[model samples]
Target: MATRCDAIVIGSGQAGPFLAARLAAAGRHTVLIEREHLGGTCVNDGCIPTKTMVASARAAHVVRRAAEHGVTVGGPVGVDLRAVKARKDRVVAQSVDNLTQWLTNLPNLRLIRGHARFVGPREVKVGGETLAAPQVFINVGGRALHPDWPGIGEVRVLDNTSMMTLETLPEHLVVVGASYIGLEFAQMFRRFGAQVTVLEAAERAVAREDPEVSRELQSILEREGVAFHFGVRGAKVARSADGGVHLALNAAGVAREIDASHLLAAIGRRPNTHDLGLERAGIATDARGFITVDDQLRTSVEGVWALGDCNGRGAFTHTAYNDHEIMADNLLAGAQRRVSDRIPAYALFTDPPLGRIGMSEAEVRAMQKPALVGVLPMSRVGRARERGETQGFMKVLVDARSERLLGAALLGIEADEVVQTLLLAMQADLPVSLWRRSVPIHPTVSELLPTLMAQLKPLEEIPR
Candidate 1:
């Protein structure tokens, strides 16, 4: 027998629980189905757990450099990998418990724990039960991609999820990508007293960013003894007779081999849309299997929509939550909102984090439009000097005619939080002149923004 509901939410990721709650609060019968843990990837493996471990790594880094700050420790600084994993587990468990409790107690909402598959239009099957609703929402998140390299099945390899389960640190950790995930783990393991080496097929790290940004970030990581090999190709993995991992890599037609204690593949991620039986429901997906959706996040099938990493619109936690907001406002609140209306913003959670919003300098230059540009080094920031953690720079671009902020990137201490101010101004379509005239607090990294705006100049070729 099919159970009729007002709304059916599949995969309790960042979007499902909240959207289901909204439907239930509106006096509609709602069913939320989750195949995995509550709070999806963010709580289980992605943001929450990774950032918690990042914090521990930062603590280890700080203690190692305590001598420079005139603080003395009685003994040598060392990180217990087991203790770090325990702390991360506690943080993640607490979040999952809280979210699960709230969803369980919510009125008029049923929580189903099983994999959901589309059976027909506006209907899904989980376990032996068929759930039919007028509105169907899919919020299934993504997972780390395991490359089908030769000999991959013979040797054990760690992805992002498996990396969190380490009790003992590796002696030599070889990372297979120089992307965000790979770089973060490289530095984290290095700080924990492991020899870290990163391999990237591209010529630079984070190829999406400006060339200078990539070079500078690579330089920062290299300074910490994190080895990097770019332009790598023809990579293969194998198990050594001595119970170790062996990697053979080719760069510029030259073969290179490395033996390491552990290997982590952090190349990319893919949506969890393959097994959902979308073909049964006539739902459309991209070539890469991401559910296709309009600007309003509407899928091809009527009364069905996809959110979170499944939709391929945006993958971050904040963006996923915002997706629920956009859809709920349009459907329940009788307002017209769109995913495109929001500006793109995200952070790379390195020790000296990278906060970026809007267009990159390369993007602006590619447009060939007149633009006002500003650049400032973290070494010049008062707060960075006080903390002895200066490693990056800030760059901003504005429309020359309107003086409106086009984009900004802050890569220094506290850049993750401080960049929000610029995001707000850009969201409001405010002018840079307003920021230049405003007085900002002293002894802070953000206080330099006003001064940076004051130095806006005509765009020119990047310095040699």
Candidate 2:
């Protein structure tokens, strides 16, 4: 016999549990299904675990730089990989436990521990039981993309998830991609006393950012002993006789080889829609397998919605959480919220993190939009200099006609948090003059925002 419910939430990801809670609180019977761990990638493998490890890496880096801060350590700083893993495990476990407890306590909500597959437009099969509901929400999330490269299947390689489980640090870590994920791990392992080399197929690391920002970021990482090979092509990997990994590639028409103790492939991510049986539910997906959804996160099929990375909209946890809010508002509160109304925002958790909101300078130019731009180095920020961490710069862009803030890229100490203020300002549609006139607290990295805005010049005035 099949169980009937008012709603079905597939995959206990950032959007699933919240949506299920809202439905259950309204006295609707809801069933939330999960085949693996709760909290999806964010708690199990992605954000929570990686950020916890990044924090440990930052501590190690700070200890090594204590002398520059006038604090001397008697002995050489060393990283115990086991201890770091233990701490990360504890944090992840606690988060999963909290979510599980909350879901269990919710009335009219059944948390099913099994894989779910669509059997009809409004029904799914989980283990031996069948569930049917008028409303079904898919939040299955995504996983690391594994590219089809020669010898990849024969040789051992680590993805973002598997790399975090390592108990021993590699002597030489070769990262195959230069995206945010690759760079974060590259720097983290480098600070843990590993020789890290990052290779990117593009002309620069983070191709989406302004060329100058990419160059500056490369310089900062290089100063920390991280090697970068840009414009690489025809890359292949194989096992060497010394039990290490051998990577061969061409850069600038010169062929080279890299022999490393470990290789991490941080190419990208793919949506988890392969086994969902979306066809059974008549849900449309893109070429990349991401579910095609409307601005309100509704699929082509009625009563079926897709959220999170699987939806091909936004991939960040915050975006996924907001998806839940949008759906809940429309379904429960009679409020009309949409996925299109969000400003793009995310952070890279490197030592000097990169905080970005809205479009990048390159993106703005690609749209052929006339804009005014401002640039400020972290060296000019009193807090960065005081902390002996002056390594990056801040940049902002404004529409030439409206003088309204369009985007911001902050790459420095606490840049992640500092960029949020600009994000909020952009969201509020504040004018450039407002940012220029606002007085920020002294000796802070964010205080330089007003000074940066005050120096805004025509885009042409700024050097490429």
Candidate 3:
């Protein structure tokens, strides 16, 4: 006999908990199933833990550069990696515990700890019991891809999740993949006193961005003592008797090897949908194994939906949370919200983060719209200069004829927060003409945005 519910939510990821809460509050009996920790990847391995350690790394960096700011320390700055790990663990634990408590206490909701495999379109089986529902939501999220690259079986490796368990910093950390996750970890470990090397299959650091963006980011990482070897499609690894890792690489046909203390395979992420028995539920997945969802995030099956990383629409935590908002609004409030309504916005966490929104320069150029571009270096920003952290640039694009904001890429001190000013204007459909006229608070990084707008030129006039 199957236990019936009003709705069954799979995976307690970014979208699941809040959506389940709303469903339960509306008098539906909601069952949320999980196989592991609460709050999914962000609270466990991805955002919270990584950012906590990034904060520790940043602290170490600030202390190392204290001499530049005329702050004299009595002794050499040293990082306690164990202490850093402990602090991260504590913060993560607090978050997980709080979320777990709230979910368990949610009225009309049942928090089930088990793996859910869909037996039908609107029903799932967890452990020895079957759960049937009229509606089902899948938010299973994703995990780091452990590729069958050469010699992968020979050496111990760390992905994003296992890397968090590190209590000691690596002497030399070789990170595979030069995208956001890989670069962030490379910089973080480098700041924690690891000699870091990054290997990318592409010619550039972040291949998806504008070539200039990639170049500047690579330069920043290089200046921070992180080595890069790009255009490497394959690598062979082995562990020595002394516990050191040896990586043999071929970058554009030139072969090289790196003897390092650790290896991190930050290649990519695969959706957690593999084990969910989507075929049994008659659900459709993309070639990459991501759940296929429409604009409203509905799956192929009736009354089924997928959200967050598993849906392939977006990967960031913010996107997943927004997915929850969209799902809730559409289901509960009768609004016709959509996944397409979202503008792409995310920040890369480096020493100085890169905040990006909307189309890239390449995308804008391909669109062939008459666009105006504005560029500014961090050196010119008052706050960046005053903080002695001027090391990047800001670039924004606008549709020339309409004067509407198009896109922005900010890479510098407080760039993550600074880019929001442009994000809001773009989302609100505010024109750059009016945006530039407003007086912003003086001496801040964002105030320089208006100054940036004043320097707009034809997009083609700007060199990437």
Task: Give one digit per residue, the lDDT tens place, for model 2 in 192-287.
Answer: 899999988888998888887788888888999999998898888788898888888898678999899988889889999999889988888889
Residue range 136-226, candidate 3, lDDT tens digits: 9999999888757777788888999999898888988989899999999999999999899998888988899988889999999999899
lDDT of each: 0.90, 0.91, 0.91
lDDT of 3 at 98: 96
Per-residue lDDT, model 3, residue 377, is: 91
lDDT of 1: 0.90
Task: Return the lDDT, model 1, position 202.
Answer: 89
Stretches of candidate 3 off by over 4 Å are none
lDDT of 3: 0.91
Tens digits of per-residue lDDT for model 1, 1-464: 78999999998889989999998998999999999899999999988999999889889889889999999987988889999999999999999999999999999999999999999988899999999998999999998887677887778889899998999999899988888899889888888889999988888898888887788889988998999888898788899997778888886567899999988989988999999999999999999899999999999999999999999999899999999999899999999999999998998888788999999988888888999889999999998999998899999999899999888888889999899999999988889999878888999888999989999988875552
